[model samples]
Target: MMMVQPKLTVVGAGPGDPDLITLKAINVLKEADVVLYDALVNSELLRYVNPNAEQIFVGKRRGCYRYQQEQINELIVERGYSKGHVVRLKGGDPFIFGRGAEEMEYATAKGMDVAVVPGISSSLAVPAYQNIPLTKRGSSESFWVITGTTKQHKLSEDIRLAAKSNATVVILMGMGKLSQIVELFQKEEKNELPVAIIQNGTTKKEKIGIGTVDTIENIVEEQQLSNPAIIILGEVVNHRNEILQVQRNINSKLTKSA
Candidate 1:
């Protein structure tokens, strides 16, 4: 009998909302024999996994990683070859700073059939949920998404250029570097530029802290915002206030009618 090679599927679980998960991701989870999920992923998503499937927690949290990257890669390859079907469920889009590419590379190197299912990236969804559009007809023509931390745990040089450009800037996993990021803009005389930091966006625990480059770092500190947050910097941040005002007016009219 010819041997059958096991398959590996990396599915993006979307931003924290369970309903945001795509049907394709759910389908793959239901067919999985083993599921390795991240910490940021909503626990509700696990319900989609087959009842007989083995679930593993491999998420990385502040100052603690359940499984190191090297170990995770090896485990995926091992399970993919031995287990009938393996699903690596990640938070947000697997390619959007989710480290899904590394896993895919490792799996293919081991001769395993790998597949990817893209999810809604918090970079775009989080800002939209807060009523902040990444681009506007006259305000911004482009947007740049940047990682807050580099291999050395320092701010990326791209942020400097981003601050100097007219493009909207979105920073992921950058709450810790908030002070430095704000200072970068301050150096470029963008002190009054609007900035908003949203923590746990798209979930029930969501909180948004809005300020300007001059005051945003302090506002985020006072609000106790932390990781798993998205930082948006540009004129687009002001749109949220306009949206809220419009919503308040509508609510007032409805209440009076009632």
Candidate 2:
């Protein structure tokens, strides 16, 4: 019998919400012979996996990594070919700061058949959940998504440009540098620009802290919002309150009808 070449499937688990996972991702999980998942991926989604599938936790959190990126790459390549059907599940869209490309590059270079299933990125979904549109007609014509930390563990230089531009700015993995980010906006004379930070967005523990560049850092600090959070800045942040008010009124009406 001819040997069947093993294959690797990289699936994005979406944000924190298990329901946010795509049907395709679930289908792929059900077929997986082995699954390696990240820390940010919701464990709830794993229930869809084949009961006999091997599940490995290779999560990386702030200040801690169970397995470095290089190790992760090697494991994926090794197990993918050995395990027949391998699923590397990542949180959010794999390409969007999820390091999905790096893993795919390694797997493909090793002659393994690889595929990607995109997930809903928190960059857009988190803001929407908080009622902060990344772009609104006549408000922001463009939007920029930036990483809060660089390979050097320092704030990225692009943030300076983002601070100066008229585009709505969404910063991921930036809670630790909240003060530095706020300082950047202040330097650009955008001190009063609206800003909102959401922690564990789309999850039950979701918390949103809102203020302006001059005060957001303090707001986040007081709220104890930490990493695994996203910072949204621009006029769009102002719309959250309006949307909340509308929601409240609708809820009240429903209650009265009931």
Query: Model-by-model lDDT, in order?
Result: 0.92, 0.91
- Please give, for residues 1-258, the per-residue lDDT of candidate 2 as tens digits: 556567888999998989999999999999998999999999899899999999999998777999999999998877876777889999999999999888888889999889999999999999898789999998899999999999899998989999999999999988778789988899999989999999999999999999999888779778998879999999999889988899999999999999
lDDT of 1 by residue, 184-243 (tens): 999999999999999999999999899999998779779998878999999999888999
Each candidate structure's TM-score, on Cα atoms with residue i matched to residue i, is 0.96, 0.94
- What's model 1's lDDT at 248? 99
What lDDT score is found at residue 175 in candidate 1?
Answer: 83
Best by lDDT: 1
Pull out the clashing pairs in model 2.
Answer: none
Off by over 4 Å in 1: 1-4, 254-258
lDDT accuracy of residue 161 in candidate 2: 93
